[model samples]
Every structure is written in C-alpha cells, then in structure tokens.
Target: MLITRRFFPYFVTQCLGALNDNIYKNVLLLLVTYSQVNELPISVNMFVNLAAGVFILPFFLFSAHAGMVADNVDKAMLIRRLKLIEFIIMSCAAVAILSQSYLVMLLLLFLMGTQSAYFGPVKYSLLPQTLKENELVTGNAWVEMGTFISILVGTLSAGLIVASDNSLVAASATVVTLAAIGYLSSRAIPALPPQGKIEKIRFTPLSGTWRSIAKVRQTPSIWMAILAISWFWFLGATYLTQFPNFAKLHLHADATVVSLLLALFSIGIAVGSWICERVSYGHVELGVIPFGVLGLTVFGVDLIFAIPPAPVDLSTVYSFSTFIAASQHYRVMADLFMVGLSGGLFIVPLYAFIQSRAEKGECAQAIAANNIVNAFFMVTAAVLSIVLLGLLEWSIPQLFLLLAALNTVVALYVYSQVPEFAQRFVSYILSHVMYRVNVTGREHIPAQGAGVIVCNHVSYVDALIIMGSSTRPMRFVMDKSISEIPLLKYLFRHAGVIPICSPKQCEKTYEQAFEHIHQALNNEELVCIFPEGRLSADGDIAEFRPGIERILAADPVSVTPMALKGLWGSYFSHKGGHALTTRPKRFWSRVEVNIGETVNGVELGRHGLHQQVSELFERKS
Candidate 1:
C-alpha cells in the first residue's frame, strides 16, 4: 500500500504526537475532576476550558518564527529536534503527574502547546516538497486520518487509564512511551532540507506575524483559503470541546460513552479524508468544497436534533455497550460521523489548494499565516461558546444550528469573492455534460510564450473546450455571425475573441480582424484561428484560407495545427439543417483535440500548412 512506505513514518509521528497531547491533557482534566477545591467560587470546568484556549494562543504569537525555522533548517533534523523537545515536555508531564501538581500540569500543557505551534508550519509545508502533485490529496488524507485516529485512541485510553487505581503511573508511562515512539518515527523520516535560502530570523513577534500575514493578503485566493481553514478549526474546536459534556449531560451517559462518541467522530473524519483522495482524482478539486459545506450545514443541523433532551438523574457508570442500547446515542453517533465526513471533504481541498498555489519556498510562511488565523478563530469560538451557552442561556442544540447557518453565509461570501472556486464548479459540470475531451500531443504547445493556433472549426463550443484544456490563455477568431449568439457572445467578448467576416462579404471587417490578430501576436499572446474560414458543411476537411499565411507573413511566429474530432456530432454541429438539435444515440460522446508539430512559417505556405493539419486530424480520428 502507498500508505505503508511513503506515509507511514509521518503517520506514526502524528499519531504519537496526538496521543501524547491528549494523554497529558486528559490527565489535567482528571486532576480538575478530583480537586479538593472543586467547590470554589470559580467554576473548575471554566478554568479547564480556559487552559485549552491558552494552549492554542502560542500559535498566534509564534507561528511566524516557527515558519522561518521550518524554511531555514533541514526538515528531518527539525523533526528530530522537536521530538527531543517532546521528550523533555513529556518528562515534565510525568513529574506533574507524580507530584499531583496542577500548576506544574498547567505549565506543562503550555509547553506542549509551544511544541505543537513550532511543528505546525513544518508539518503542512513538508507535504508539497516530499510528495508528487498527483499524490498530494492522498498523502494529506493519510496524515489527517492518522492524526484523528490518534486523537480517538488517546482520548479513550486517557479516560480509562487515569480512572484506574494507579492514575499517576499510568499517565506517566503512557506519555513517556508515546514520546519515545514519536522520537523513533522522527528518526526514520528521510532527510528533507529547506528548498531555498533563509533570511535572518525575525525576533519581533508582532512584526514577523504581520509580515507573514501581509504576504498571504497579497494573494486573494490564498487569503480566502486561509479563512476557510481557520473557520474549519474554529467550528471543530467548538464541537469537540462540547462533545464530552453533551454525551454526559444530555444523553445521561458516562466517560466511556463520551469516548465512544469521540471515536466515531474521529473514524468518520478518517474515512472522509481517505475518500477525498479518491473522489478528487489526486487534484485539489475545488468543486468538492461546496459539497462539503452543504454536508456540514445539513449534518450539523441534524446533530442538534439528534441530541436527546436532558435526562433526569444522569448516570455516571455508562459503558460503551450500555450507551449503544439507547437509540438517541446511535443517532448522535451518526450525526458526528456525517460531520466528520463533511469536514474531511472541506479541509483536504483547502490544504491542497494552498500547497499548490502558494509562492514557492514561502509555503511554510503561508501556512504559518493560516495557523495564526486558525488560532484567532479558535479563540473566537471559545469566547462565543462561553457567552452564548454560559451567559445567554442558549442550549447546545441552538448553538449547533447557529453555527450551521453561519457556515452557509461564510461559504457564499467566500465563493462570491473568489470566482475561481465557482469557475471550477462550472468547468466540472460542463466537462462531464458536453463530452469527454481527450488531448493528444499537448506538449507540442509551448509551455510559455505566444504562438498562433490554426485549426479546422467543428462546433460552436470548440473554443470553450480548448480554452478549458489549454494551460495558457488563447484569443480565438470566430465567424461574425456566430460571435453574435447571445450567451456565447458574452463569453466570447470577455475572452477577447475576435469576430471576422469573409473578405468577399465584408472586406473592412476582415481587415480589422487581421489587425487584431497581428496586435495579439505582437503582444506575445496566443491567438487561435480557423484556417477553413468556416465550419465544415459535411463533416469533411475544407480548403485552406490564405488569411493564416497573411497573418504569419506579417509576424514570423511558429504555427501550431490542431483538429477537433467527435464534435461533429455535438448539439451545435450543423446536422439536418437544425443547429440546435442533438445527434441521435449520443449519450456519451468522445471528443479528441489533437495538436500537431509546430510548422515554421517561413517554410510552410497556406496550402501546405492546411494539408498537414488536415492529415493530422484524419489520423487522430
């Protein structure tokens, strides 16, 4: 399995890290549970919640420095050093456990948070460097699955172990053992160095943070993606922190029941993450983002309804088996699973998009900016939960619905601001509906710079399909009559398509079109023209027009020949004297766009170029 060799070590490291984190955290919660001062004026539960918030605060303050370190140093070495730091932190945690010191435990929690903050940038930024572009979604999926599974195991084990007779010893042994495992995994990771040179580390935390923030802001899409990621964490933190209370108070369950709910949630996320890699076909398909948001909105509301009303006299001894006896418990579990699935669909794409599009060598910094925003959002969630639940007397179910509605508003706003995400949605729909487009000899088109593309026009949407496939933008020349088609005219005009009439019919229109083509080529822009000067009347190659030769003679540029096949039977094709009718028996049509060798303008005249291009098309057909 690809997960075994390439992803295992990273997975092990993440799992161990999460295990250590939760073990130590649950031990602290256990201390609060058993505290002699639990009856004090201030709520012990509130203090525990505040401690959780404080742990994430470091990410906001220090992520910039963390990003710099990840960018400057060897990544494997950095992981090794971070693992050593974990060992020290876990040792401190052990001491806190042995001594039963809340102060020490709280301090150690801060230290653990610091370690995680430092690792955040390196963890995400390393994926793009190590994995191929095609492997990114799968690699991220495995990582996310490992992280969540660890959380489930760690949360469950911590509750069971700390509730034992020898709580201190159990906690100490668990943390130290996990820390050792983490270190071993770090050792196994192959060496990966910073991809580029590093500048001097910025010591001013605020300034460094602002600078990192500014870099992301400069790229609108990156900024939007960061916002999306931040919101995910914010919503997740709120839901996760509330689960234990919800299971215990609302469902009249116990610690084991809470653990079971957590397990289901984690498993759902893992399953969803794994599925995202497959559904996306290895690319960061933004089309999945809306679907994810839809699921989140639907399942989130269902979770509120799924929760049972407060039980009279809640039980403290509910086990996993006993919890499953209640139908409401199963309903809650199903809701959590759906939530996890939606979250998986949402997060994987955002991370992949950020990795793929961020400025090279500054990925760590960009991710660092995202972490900072995420921390702020988490803080907001914490504060909002406190005010709404604690002060305003809002029920947990009400809060869940509010969050769901908020998700809809936020998703719409983000999609409106960045049309690329929506554009991908359109492209995805059109590609599947129109036909499967196959391109051959695509490498013949230069990766960079301008070239004139001459092809035999086959259908109305031919340019749209080609535009969708071509990595570089091209200006197309279309017949004046077709260019006036209502909806298509808008798209054509926006795309800078030039309209040309036959020279015999409208000589001035023909001259103006040629001038526009000339200007486009001189500006080093790709310009595509139909050398047949008209669509094929009988689905056969037509005589070549000399207009291409005239354009080429004016500017000596390489000419790329292309053909459109299977489009002959498309809805827009001239069939049975009705332009709008579809070809019979055409449920799934196969269209191929084949590009031929670049013909030297100086060597190939109009007729020679036309013959070569036509033959290439016939061969491809």
Candidate 2:
C-alpha cells in the first residue's frame, strides 16, 4: 500500500510535514535551551512550555473550520494547498533563523500550527475514504510509524546541526527544502471526493467548533474514544515539550543526549505501531489498549526513579556517548522506550476505532473535535507543567510522576464509560497470549450489517475466542448457566451477551432471549450462537439444536458458519475434569477459528449448517 500512488504520496507529504515541524520547533527549542542565541526575556522553562502552548493554540481555535473545509472540498486538493502554506511558513522561518529573531520565530510557530491544524482533519478523514475496511488499521499503523520515525530523524538532525558549524544556515536550508519536497509529494496523491455531505461552508469559527463537538457527542462511545485520544496527547505533550529541560536538569545531559532520548522514545512508538499492525491481524483490534495503559503508568513511574541525581558539579554535562556508556542510563532509555511503545499501542486503535464508529457524514468533524480536545489537553499539559515546575518548584521528574498518576485516573474513567475496551482487553489477552488463535476466512464475516455466526461450542471461553477473532463487536447468545458464571457474567453481561435457557428452565427467559437476538440482528449487529446448546462435554462435536433455525426464520439474515478447532484440551474446555476446577497446568495453546462462506437466501437447516461446519473442521486449520 505504501508503494502505490494512492497512499505513498500522502504518506510522504504528512511525514515531511511532521519532520519539518519537529526540526524547526526543536531548533528553536535547542537554541533557547542551550542559550546559543540572545538571552530570552523569560527563563528557558517558560520559553519551552510557552512554545508548546503557542503551537497548539491554533488547533483549538481553527480546527472546526478546518474540518468543515476538509469535508466540503476535495481532500487531495486541500492537502496540496496545506502543503503550499507549509512552504510559505518555512520560508519565513528560514529568514527568522538567519536573522536570529526570537519573536519572529515565535510568531511563525503560530503560523506553523495553523497549517497543521488545517491538515489534521484532512489527513485522518482521507484514510477511511480511500482505503478498504481491513486496511484502516494498517494505514493508521503506517502513518504513526512514519510520523514517529520522521520525528526521530528530525530530532536527531536538529541536534547534530545545532552542534555543527554554520548552524543557522544549515537549519534554514533544511526546513525549506523539506517543505518544498512535501508540497511536491502532495501533488501526486490521487484525488478523493470529500467523505462528508456537502454542507453550507460556515465561517463562524466558534459556532462551527461547537457544531463539530456536538456531532462527536452524538455517539457516547466515540466521544469517550476521543477523550482517550486527547488524554494520550496530554501525556505525550508533557513528556515531549519538556524533554530538553528534563534531560539537562535531571540527567545533566547535553543537546546530543536529549536527541538520543527522543530517538529512543520515537523509535519505540514506531516499533509499537508496527506491532499493532501485526497483532491486529488485518483489522483494528482494541484489546491491546488496556495493555498499553498498563505500560504507560508502569514505565512512566519507573522513569522517575530511573534518573540519576543532579550532578554535583553544575558544569558537568553528559554527551550522547557518555550517557549511554553508563549501565545506569540503560534503565532510563528502556523506560522511555516502554512509555512510547505503550502510547503507540494505546493511540492507534483509538484512532481506528473512532474512524470506524463515528457517523460517516460527521467523521471529519468528529476528528476535528478530537483535535480540538487534543489541543486543549496538550495546552493544558503545557500550562500545568509551568505551574508545577516553575511556580511550585517541582522537578521535571516530579512532573512525570504526576502525569502517570493522572493517566491512571483518566484510564479508569474511560473504562467505566466504555466497558467494551476493558472487555476486549481481557479477550485480547486470552486469545492472543493464553491461546494463539489463527483465524481463516475473516472476510466471510461482514464488516457491517447483520450476520449470524454459528460455531461448534468447544469450551466455556468460546465466546471470548470468537469475540477476539472478530474486528467488530459480537453479541454472543450463550447458555444462562455459563453466561452467569460469576466472573464471566460481569464481562459478558455488560458486553451485551445474550443469555438464553431451555423452556423448562424458564419460559419467559427463553422467549426474551429470542427477542433480544432478533433485536440485535435487526440493529445490524453480529450475533454469534453456539448451536450445540452446550459445550462439547466429551471433546466431540455435539448435534446442533433447532434454535438456530428459529433464529434464521425470525431474522433471515446471512449466516456465517465458523469452527473452533484445537480448543478441546485447554483449561477452559471439558477435557481436564472440569474448566477451572483445578490448578491450571497449560497455557499458550494453539487454536484456530475457521470462518466459512456466508450461506443465505435458501434456508440451511441446523443439520445442513452443521455439516458445513464439520466439513470446515475437517480441513486442516
């Protein structure tokens, strides 16, 4: 996909933009941090945090209008235009660097931010419009990979150039050349009609801002996803904006050392993005998010302790080579890497989730609202750091400690609001780690619309395995007894699992279960039912029951026949006395979920479907 005309150009353009942004921004930051230029009116800490706020302010101010413009125009054309604006901003930045004008550079920060604010909506909205459903996760993964890699290279470039002779000329030349190339790359991107409905081009920024946010709020889950994304930026902004001062003050490091830390952090995110693509299995998977959240707080707190105390000599400074030479510094590098890695895992899925779930017509607006919130949080991060570090006299490491604590609170709240994230996290760990699941015929399960998935019930954890196999949420129709198991019950119940019973157990419960299944199917939800009506107690396929026929008669939706293989002996299965009846002896078992072609129109009775499933099972997984 990256080699194609459709995606590569856009990728190049966006990456170059991120590269140049970091280069120019860091050049200014390094000059101020090292006191290479005329003394600033404010302290170095004030200047760094102030620069972050200046750059992020435009996103808050103009993102709504930008989102509307992106949706109303051709995204390809808008991208090109935005790139051209970037070129002009770089031109002015070049002149500022040559003249050493601190205020001019600061003003250009606002202009650069304005260009990026406009570009953000177009960049995100363009992907879902241009790519296939399965490609969304891969695309987001690649974009993140490119963005962070560019940031890494740019940061290293800025550090090395600042340390070089004729630094001003080199920095000016670099930003302009990159901007021009980014503009040229934008020209090759294939044109795409805007994905949003053409609406009146409203010029009122305040009203449009509210309008976009209101659009996002229409879906509570999407809104929560946006907030989660925003919180990530908040944490990211705090760490990135203060990296220079943090390294200098805490580690007693030079500019080269700061570059090394940023490089490790950036590469970690890129690696995590690549891993997200691999683990996603050609679709966006949300299960890794909680895993990411765990790492963010864990490594973030560790970083505070990982730091060496301030040097006894104020003049002492560790260069990149010296910093890494010591074994103690390895802990700091690893901590930074893990924080970035977790952030990548946490961020990519939320971006894909919002894209897949947001209202189609308002997708861009939803992303715009995300940008607005992200900017708000990031700006707040900047301000909060100033309050903590400057006014309160807290150390940079102390600020990091605060960030980790806040992240935990924020994550718990989001999990409360959006329980599916937590549910998928559990399923994700179970399927991806405890059991290695290889799924075939994933395409047979529709990306949208209603479908019935009837799989042979091999274990009590069948619902979780099937849920993890799917990209979309699957509403499992399960036995009341299994569904009510104390631990699994809470996970399944809140996840919308439908619990059913035989007529003898409770006539009303039996009737309501079918009603709920019908409602789920009518709502275009994927409904999975174990037609065996119970787990295979003897490690063989049980004869499917007639309830499947009742479901088909009621909904008449397409049925996807799936087979769960290699799960008979796992702890959750009946092979070892009883599931969870004794101490667990095995884990990391290999399992396969084979999805057969969707059979529709003609009624396939339970027996017929069972034959197809059996045939699927017979095929080597």
Candidate 3:
C-alpha cells in the first residue's frame, strides 16, 4: 500500500512537535534546578510537576472533542489549524524565554500540551482512511520510530542548550525555528475529509468519552490490548523520568552518560519498529509484544547489576566530556539498547491492533481513549516511581528489577486472558521457521472469508509453503499416504488439511474430500487443493484434474490459481527418487509463489477453469 501524501507532512509536524515539547520542558526543569539552586525545594519540584500535569490534563479533558473534530472536519484543514495554533504556542514560549519569565514558560508548556492533545486523535485516525489494512502496521511503525527519534534529538538539544551560558537565547531561537518549519510542512499535507458525518455535535464530553470507551470494551480482546499498550507507556514514562537520577545516584555517571542511555533506548525502539513491519509480513502480529516485554524485564533487571558503584567525589559537577570517560558507559549502553529494542517490539503491535480492531468511523475516538489511558498511566508511573525511590527506599537497580518482574507477570496474565495473541505467536514462528518463503500478489485473494485456491502439484512441502505465505489460514487437500508423514502429519492435522484418494482407488475417500471442501467454504474457510492431483512426474506442469471444478461448482466461490517456482529440485520433491532426504542441501533457495487474479465461476466452465490454471502456470514458467 502507498504512503499517502498526507503522511509525510504529518510525520514532520509530529517530529517537530515532539522536539519542541522536549526541548522546552527539559530546559525549564534544568533552569529551575541550576539557576535557583538555593530556592529549589520540594515545593518547587511539585510546582514543576504540576506544570507537566497541566499539559497532559488537556488530553483527558479535550481529547473527546478533539477526536470529534478530526472525525467531523476535513483532516488537512484541521491539521492546518492545529499547526497555526502550534505557531502561536511556540511564539509564546519564545517570548517567555527571551524575557526569562518562568511563569510564561510554564503557561506555554500547558498550551503546547493542549495542541498535542488535539493532534493526537487526528494523527492516528487518518492512517486507516488513507492506507490499506495490510499497510497499517508498517505505517504505524514508521510513525512511532520517527516520534521516538525526534524526542531523542529534542531532548539532546534541551540538555546542550540549557547547559550553555546563554541558554535562554539559544532555546528561544530553536523553538521559533522548529515551529516555523513545522507550519511549512503542514501546508504540504493533502486534504482528507471525514468518511461519514457524525450526528451528535452537541454531545456531552462525559457521554462521548464513555461511549468511545464502550466501543473498545465491546471487543474484550481489543480492550485487553489497549490496556497492554497503556501499561507499556507507563513503564516507558517511569524509566524516562528516573534515568537521570538512576545514572547519577546509582551508576555514578554524568549528564553525557544519561544522554547516551536515552539515545540508545530511542535507537533500539526505532530499529525494532522498522523491523516489525518487515518481520510480520505486514500484518499486526501480537506475538512480538511478549518478546518485547520479556526483553524489558530481563534487561531492565540486568541494568541494575550493571550499574557502577557511587563516585568517590559526590559533590563535584562533571561535564559531558568527563561523563564519557566513566567506566560504566559500555554497560549503560547495552542496557539502554535492550530497553529500547523491547520497547519497539511492545508498542508497534499495540498501535496496529488498535487501528485494525476499532470501529471504522470511531477510530479517532479510540485513539483518544488510548491517549487518555496513556496520560493516566503516565501519572500513575510518576507516582509509582517517586514512591519506589523515596518511601520504599529502593535503589535504582532494585526499582529496575521490580519493573522487570512486573512486566513478566503482566505479560503472562494478558496472554492467558487472550489465547488469540498466543495463537498469532505460534503462527508467526511457524512462518519464519522450517523454511523462508516469499509470496507475491497475495492481495488478489479476498481479504476475509472462504475461497478455493488451485495450484500446480510440485512437492510434499507445497502445502506447507502455501500455508507459510498466506496471510489468511488455509486448509489443504493432500494424498492420504503423504498426509500420514510423522512431523508433517502433526502440522497438517492442526492446520485442518484434508486427506484424499483418487476417485477410482477409493471413491468414499474422494467423496469425503469434496464434502469437506463444501463445508469449509460454507464456514468461510479458505481451501487450497492441487488440481494436478499428484507430484509432477517430469518436473513440468501436470494436467489439471476435474475435481477442483466440481468443488468450485458446489461451493460457488472464486478460484485463485497459483504457481510455486524453484521448488522442483528441493529434497521434498520426487526428483531424487527418495521420499525424504536426511540431509537436505536446500538453504536460502529463491522460491517465488505467484497468485493469479480470482476467476469468476459463473464465467468459466470446467474445461475453461483447467485452461485458466494452465495459462497461469505457463506465464509463471
């Protein structure tokens, strides 16, 4: 699927927004600490935190309205307006920095948060309308990866600028420049209108919020999935907020070390997100979430042990240069990479799941609900982190261990509650393992429900190859004798493959196969049968059998013809006069499975169907 013209501009806008948010927020926090050291107290910390809360508070209060606006108005127009609002907010922040007014800066931070609140719902909801279902996971991955990298750059700028002698002037100039660039990018986005009109414009905020929440709750699996996503963000927020303290107090590291840790985490997330699109065959695979959570827990605990002892001189301030010279830098880098890697694995799938499962028109509201939950969880994380560090007297390492343990427990609980997640995991592994297969033109098959697939008989492994490549599950028809192959039998049985005998040899077995095909199609299940009926005797396309036509006539479904190339020499084939070879040399062989467009049963007679299948293979050869 193509990335819509709208995505590029939206990506840049969000990137700039993330950068601006981090740069100002981090700088303000730094100034409060360094400039007013003597006056920096618990009250000051609370006030600064309150500033942070004000930004998130808008998401909870206005997200429902924001979602409505995105769904009701033209998206490109909405984005243009939001970008204008961002310009004003950034201008205010620039002015606040120029005048050295902390009060103005705090207020501007709140405004920035409010702008983001409005953008969040529109950003996600637009994707489904613009991109195809298969592209959703890949598209979401790119956005997430981009957002995290932008945060890294923004935060890095904040640290460097705040540490400079002329911090105020530097930061003010940076914010204005980024905001201007963001606005220009917003102009490039193409127009996208709401798919359908929403009738309730005068709806109460509470009712709208509850109704959006109800949409998610109606699908229990989706609800669980959303909770899982929120929990991930909560853990992420906790880790981010705690990093500086964790570095300074626990690892005896300096600001540079802390920055490196953050960068590594961001990089890992970016890499993982990009990989998710490629690895899952462009589908949202929930299996990766458990793997991600496992990494988070394991590496999070290991990071604690990896921390270096406290420095000999606790009172001294270290420069960025000095921090790089520290002994624990390598250990810190490893831990952060793992955290980010796992984080990437965790988030991309959840976003894809939300996009895929949520009701079509209410996508923005679903995302709004997600943002609300995210904000609430972040608040909870902050409280939890503070309690763990202060009241519980837990060392940073111990806190890391606790977070890891919690991840494991929560992951298990989620998988137990939703077996579909686990089933996807099994499917993901099966596709990747045994052999790597590549399929093309799979989009020709209908997105959902039952269809008949006809293919040239190549080898015993052809069914497995087809199963591995198909996005949807398919039942295969196989010779009864080969179907009994030990290891192959297990997988075939689990996959619901049917056994068939030649009509002349065993009429009952052949009749049963036809009945099974009819039943499967009736239940909206894809049934794949080799019309050639047996392995090719001379490594060439065999004549199409008449049984497939009977199956199609009985079921009245579209027939998809496919050809498996480069498998003629494989051990599984009958070429070597051996049924199965002990040492198969086939590794990384290039195999292409090409699917043809569906042929309407109404237009094609039995002989015509056979001819169509022959023509498809003719082109493939």
Give me the candidate number with maximum TM-score. 2
lDDT of 1 by residue, 136-248 (tens): 77888887888888888877787778679998898898898899889998898888887876677766688888988998999888899999988888889888878877766
Collision count of model 3: 0
What number of clashing residue pairs does each candidate have, in the order they appear? 0, 0, 0
Model 1 lDDT-worst window of ten: 423-432
Residue range 350-399, candidate 2, lDDT tens digits: 99998888656667778899999998887788779879988999988888
Question: Any idea how many clashes model 1 has?
Answer: 0
Q: Name the runs in model 3 displaced over 4 angstroms.
A: 1-6, 37-42, 96-105, 132-138, 164-166, 196-199, 277-291, 310-319, 326-328, 356-359, 417-420, 448-557, 563-591, 605-621
| lDDT (CA) per prediction | 0.80, 0.88, 0.78
Candidate 3 residues 1-621, lDDT tens each?
A: 334574777788878878888888888877776677353334667767877887788877777778877888888888889888888888888888777777777778888888898899988888878777678888888889888998999888887898888888998889888888988988988888877766465545667666667777887777788788888888888788888887677666677767877888889999988877777687667756777887888888888777666667787555566666765656767878988888888889888887776666777878888887788899999888879888988877777788889988888888777665665565455345544556777788776678888888878878867765564567899888778899667666766789998988999998999999889999888888887788876678877777876887787888887887767777778776754863576765767778888988546755666676667656643
lDDT score of residue 16 within candidate 1: 89
lDDT accuracy of residue 383 in candidate 3: 86
Candidate closer to the true structure by lDDT (higher is better), 1 or 3: 1
Model 1 has an lDDT value of: 0.80
**lDDT against true structure, model 2:** 0.88
TM-score of 1: 0.82
Compare candidates 2 and 3 on lDDT and give the better one.
Answer: 2
TM-score of 2: 0.92
